[model samples]
Target: MDWNRTKSIFIVVFLILNIFLYSLYVNRYNEAQSVEVAGEKTIDARLKEDNITYGVLPNSVESATYISGKVHTFTAADFTDPNHQANITDPKEARVILLSPVKLRNVNDDASFTEFVQANIKEGGSYGLWKVNRDERIAIFFQKTNNRMLYYNKSGLLKIQWNADNEVTMYEQTMLDNIEEVEQQESALPPIQVIQALYAKGLLKPDSRIEHMQLGYSTLVYLTQTQVLLPTWEVRVKLSDGEIEEYFVDAVEGKIIEIQEEKQEVEEEDWGV
Candidate 1:
């Protein structure tokens, strides 16, 4: 029997299998990385198309810096904490408030935002859109977390600003006469219900995946925005005559902010996904 030769063959085969497995792992890793980069590029393209001027999305402010002019750069680093608010230190003048003082990020879902809005604040239907009264800017950000809603904002700073305002200070204090009154409460609207309403109204596409959404409004001025990543713009419907509209619409106000067609990428390959 050729036992020594058999053992040598087995070792060679084992080494080859290990090499094959390592190659597979490397290939898979590269594929996942590519997908993430593509997703980020898609997001950046959308932002540019919408005319939203933002420096690179900063993971941390450590890499962030204020360049000359009105431009700022946000580097890729995680934020110190959700508590970190956008600095308004360079008050040679009041900042143009390009993005607003409120920083919205890491939103898990829409309901968390609506609920937070419904609580701490009061929502009275006004001119068809849901209105909440507050003097300072309130920012809301959205991100998918475990398939649930997540919200990020400078709530603490907002509260401070509201308290400083003499006009709404009294009103807010009256509303918070008791500690329990001011405590955080979940939204009365369920996550599914809120999503369903947007869907039924055709404001949100059935297949749209909301990555980052923001809401900014101050009683002194009228500015409201909601941004979401959608698969198509064919979902928006006109409330005037129940006609199907697509893409951008002021779902909250029943108005159109702007409607821009999705940009298609040109590919050289005739048959490609």
Candidate 2:
């Protein structure tokens, strides 16, 4: 055998294989770019035709992981405070009703209200004020995990009902326990892509304005004792009729999530004040 000749032939074959692989990679990259460009143009045209406008879209891509937690069961031992009376409505759901009133120095002051919660409520520091309804005289707080809100999760909510005197007469609470990340970090869909998803689904109407877009977590699966949550994008839109609507999109799978309306109004009689 001709040693030099054999070595040269092997080298030539390796070079050919490398060239073939490189060409394939370039072709795939170009095709991906073309598809992305086409998608952008299509979305832009559709949005213009529908007269849809949006505020500044988030540009940075983010990664998140799936989290799971079990709802904490409330027991009499959990509430040892002498000032408030705690009623455990549902032990499995960890629902508690507080009957005693705790006056707030200033509900309008964030720091003051936070101090009140921390001093009066259990695991209160983990909750953040989500909304205040003056008509219902109620303030709703949601629990935060790793500094991010578990949006609209029933097992992690605190609802406080206050009288006209600015005294918190009653409240309902739920909490989650053993919270931990259940999956590896995965890249989430960008905000603009989520908008496009809503647009494609015909959820975005003509002359609508996207007011806000935020990343949060929504319940992906609910069980008897535990729940799984996924990264979600919450988009708030102002319709032409001046009505504000909120939509959620699954950031990982780009699917629209239909969230049922949770009643915020608490009857005066229910407060037992």
Measured against the true structure, the TM-scores of the candidates, in listed sequence, are 0.27, 0.81
The digit string of per-residue lDDT tens for model 2 on 31-136 reads 9999998998899888989899987887646798899999988898877876667666667433334456677888776565666677788899999887776777
Top candidate, metric lDDT: 2
As a whole number from 0 to 100, the lDDT of residue 67 in candidate 1 is 10
lDDT of each: 0.28, 0.80
Looking at candidate 2, the ten consecutive residues that score lowest on lDDT are 261-270
Model 2: what TM-score? 0.81
Residues 1-273 of candidate 1: C-alpha lDDT, one tens digit per residue: 799999999999999999999999999999999996786566446534543232222121111111111111222121233332333332211111112223222233333334333333321111011222242422222222112111111110112121232211111100100111112322232222223344445455332343322222111111122122211111222333334433332223323333231111110111111
